[model samples]
Target: MTDELRSAALESKAWPYEEARKLLKRYPDGKPGGAPVLFETGYGPSGLPHIGTFNEVLRTTMVRNAFHTLSDLPTRLIAFSDDMDGLRKVPDNVPNGDMLREHLGKPLTRIPDPFGKFDSFAAHNNAMLRDFLDRYGFDYEFASSTDYYASGRFDDAIRGVLRHWQGVMDVMLPTLRAERRATYSPVLPVSPKSGVVLQVPVEVVDAEAGTIAFQDEGERIVQSALGGLSKLQWKVDWAMRWVALGVDYEMAGKDLIDSVTQSSKIARVLGGRPPEGFNYEMFLDDKGEKISKSKGNGLSIEQWLTYGPEESLAFYIYREPKKAKQLHMGVIPRAVDDYWQFRGNYAGQAVKEKLGNPVHHVHDGKLPDGTLPVTFGLLLNLVGVMGEGATREQVWAYLANYVADATPAAYPELDRLIGHALAYHRDHIAPTLKRRAPAGVEVAALERLDAELAALPEEASAEDIQNIVYEIGKSRFGEEGGFAELRDWFKALYETLLGSSQGPRMGSFIRLYGVANTRALIAEALAAA
Candidate 1:
C-alpha cells in the first residue's frame, strides 16, 4: 500500500486487524527464532464443505492479510481437516446412507468411498476441501488428522495429553451434561475386534506407560497412545491439534465457542497455550435458523459461485464478522451493493474508513482492478425481464447502449454479473414470472407510452427516460394519491413487462436496453395484456 493507505490501516478498528495486532504482540520480535506465524482453520470432513467453511477460511485470510501489511514476518495458514474422526453418522448430502452406516464407528479414513472414485470417503472430502480452497488461490498449508496420527507427528501432544489426563478431564468434564461427566475420559480407544473407534469405558489409565485399557466387546484391551491406535476425544483432540501444529490463531463459528473454551483449557494442561481466537457469528438460512448441513436448507459454495463472483461472497463476509448474518440467496444483491459502495468511497474516505472497508482487506490491501458496470440487482432484474434464451452478447449489447463502453475489457465484472444474472433468472425467477396483460384503458396508455418512447431523441439519459415514465403514470393514472399512486403504476408496468411487480428503475432499464427495444417491449406488453 501507499503511505496513505498504510496510515489508514494503522488507525482503523472496524476491520479484523485489531485481532492481528494482538497476534503480533504475542509473537513479538517478528516470529522470533524463524518460526513462521501460523493461523489454522479446521474442517470436519464428514460432509461436503459449504459456505460456512469458506466464511471461516476467508475471514482468517483477511486477518492474515492484515497481519502481513503490519509486519514483515513469515506467515502460514493451515487448512486442517479432522479426517480421522469416527463416522458417527452419514452426512445427509452424500450418496449412500446404508453403505456409510455399514462402516459406522470406523474412522473416516478407514471407510470405503461410496462413489467408487477416491480411496476412502475422508480422502474424497479432503480432496474436495483442498480443491475449493485452491480454486480461490488461498495461501495455506493443508493437514489431515489421519496423517498426523498415523505418522506420529502428534505424538508429543498425545503423550502430553495422556500424562496430563486428569487435568484435561478437569477442564473438559465441567462443560458436559451430568451423565457424561460420570464416565468422561480424555481418550477414546480403537476397538481391535470391530476395527472401529469406540466410546467404551476406560478400565485403566497408565499415563506413565502412555497407554489406556478400554473395555471392548465385553473385554478390557490396551491400546498405544499414538500411531493411529488411539486418539483423544474431540475436545482434547482440538487442543492437541493446536499444540501439534504450533498454531498461533484460529477462528470458529459462535456455535463452537464451548468446544473452544474446553479446548483452550485442555491446551493449557497439555503444556501449550491455546491460540488467540475469534468466535464469528453463524450464517443463518432464509428462515432465520442457523444453516446446517443436516438440514440441507442453506446455500452451498457452488450455488453462491453460480449466482455471483467469489469477491461478492467475500464482501458478504466482510459486512460483519461478530454479529450474526444470513447467507441465503436473498442477501447476494445487498452484498454487491456494499462492494460497490465501499469501493466507490475508497478514494475520498479518510484513510481510516478507506482502509477500514473490507474491500481493502478482502483484496489484501490491493483494490480490485475492475468495476461492475451496472448494479447486480439491476442486471438481475434486466435478465428477468429479458425472458429466456438471452445470450451473453445480447445482454452485452443492451448494457453498451447506455454505458457506451461496456466492453468485456472495461467491465469484466459486469460481464460475469450479466451471465450469472441470466442463470439466476432461469433457475430461480422464471418459472413464477408474471406477464400480466394490460386491461382496458391500460392498453391505450401503454400504446401512448410506446409512441412517446419511439419519438424520443436519438439519445437520452436514464433520468430522461424515467421522467417520461413518470409522465405516463401521471397522465394515465392521475397521481393525486401521492407517491403511492406513481409507485403502483410503475409496479403494474413491471408486472406487465418483466413478470415481476418490482424491478430495476424503469428509466434506467429503458436507457440501457435501448429506446427502440423498449418500445417493442411496450408493444409486446400491450399485446400480452
Candidate 2:
C-alpha cells in the first residue's frame, strides 16, 4: 500500500466501519434473547429482481462483514421478500399477462406463476432472489413474507401492531393526503371469499382479540390477525418486519428514508426498538432519472452479470454507495478495472489499510489473492481490434503478446472476462468504435503520426512508446494555446486511431496492444483516411 493510502487508512471516515460501530452500540450485546445481531433488507417482489434490489442486500452484507471486525458476536443478515403482498398489476416482462391481471389485488403467492416454473408468481421471483444471492454465495437467510405470515410466524407481531393500532395510526395518518387519510387503515384484510386483499375502512379493530372487522363488497368479514388474513401497509409492514425479526441493523435507499422514519415510530409503538440504518441516495439511470424496476430503465441483474463479473457489480455497490451514482452499461469497464486496482491489492495490505478498502467487506474477509492481467477498458479496445465474438484462443493470442504468458488457466477470472469482454464490446463498445474517415486536418496529422511510429526503437517500453505517441499526437498540429492545443491534437489522434472521440489512456494502450500491432493499426487507419 502507498504511504498516503496507509496514512488515510488510519483516519479514513469509511462508511462500513462507521456503520459497524453504530451497529455494535445498538446491540449492546448483539440483541435480546441471545439472538445474533440481525440485519434485514427487504424486497418488494412485484417485479423481476433488479440490481437496485441486490444493492440493498449486498450493501447490508458489507456492513455485516464490517461489524464482524468490530466484535465477535454472531450475526445474521436476512434477505426478506415481501411476496405475500397483493399483486396490484402485472409486470410487462412476465409471460401470461392476462392471467396475472386477473389475480390483481390477490397475494402474489396465490397467483399462478406467469412462467409456469414455480407454483406462484411470488415463488418464482423469490426463487430468482434466492438464486441470484446463492449464485454469489451470499450468507443470508431467505425470509418470504408469504411463509412468515401463512405459518403465523409474525402472528404475535401482527397482534401487537393491532393492539397499538392508534399509535400506528398517529405515525402513519399524518403522512397521507387528506383524501387518503379518510380511508386509511394500517391493516388491509384479505377477503376469504373473494381471495383478494380488500382496501376498505376498518369497521372495528378488536386489537385485544387480534381480529379486524371490515366491510368487503357488502360482506362484513372478521379476519384473524394470524394466518395471512391481513397484510400491513407498506410502512406498517416495514416496522413489523423489524420487530418480528428483531432487526438490529439494516440499510435502505434514500427514497425510503421517510417511510423508515414513519416505520421507526410504528416500531416503537409496537413495543420494540427500531433497527439502526442509513438511507443511501438512489442510483440514477443513464438519463439521470432514478432507476425503477417497473420502468425497466435500470440495469437488470441478468444484464449486469452477462456483461461483467459479479465482483465488478460488488465494486459498484461498495463504490460511493451513499452518493447518487449513475449506473449504465457504460459504467461497467471502470468497475471492472476497479476490481484490479483496489481488491487486487487488498490481500497483503495492513489491517488499517484493509479497513479503508471495502474489498474485505465485499469478500467477507476472504479476499481474492491477485488482480487481473489487464484493465477491462484495454480488453474492450482489444476486443474491437480482434472483432466481435473473438474466441478465447484468439484473445489469448493478442493478450500473450501484450502481457507475457497470459492464460485463462493461470488467471481464473480471465475465463469469464474473456467472453464478457467480447459481449461488452459488441453491446457497449463496437457502436462507439464505428469507423470514420478522419476529417481533412485529422487525416494529415495522423498520416504524419503514422510515419513517426516507424522510427520508434524495437525494444521500447510501453512508457517509452506512450511518450512518443503523446509527443507525436500533441505536436501533430502547431502548439498554439498549450494545453487546449495539445488536447485538440490528442482528440484528433483518438478520432483517427480509436474511431471514437475518447479512448483509454493512450500510452498504456499503445504498449498493451504491442508497438508493432499499434503501428500497423495506425498505418491502416491513415491509408483508409
- Best candidate per TM-score, number? 1
TM-scores for all candidates: the values are 0.93, 0.93
Give the residue spans of candidate 1 off by over 4 A: 1-6, 203-205, 348-350, 439-448, 472-484
Candidate 1 accuracy as lDDT = 0.81
In candidate 1, list every pair of residues with a backbone clash: 434-499, 437-529, 438-529
State the lDDT of candidate 1 residue by residue for 175-257, as single tens digits. 87998887777777788899898776564456666677877878878777678887779989999888877889998989889
What's the distance in Å from true for residue 145, model 2? 1.0
Give the per-residue lDDT of model 2 (tens digit) for 265-335: 89899888999889999998999999876577888888999899888899888878778999888888888
| CA RMSD of all predictions | 2.4, 3.2
Error of 1 at 400 (Å): 3.3
Candidate 2 RMSD to the real structure? 3.2
* lDDT for position 167 in model 1: 88
After superposition, the stretches of candidate 2 with alpha carbons farther than 4 Å from their true spots are 1-12, 344-349, 477-484
Clashes found in each candidate (C-alpha, N, C closer than 3 A): 3, 0
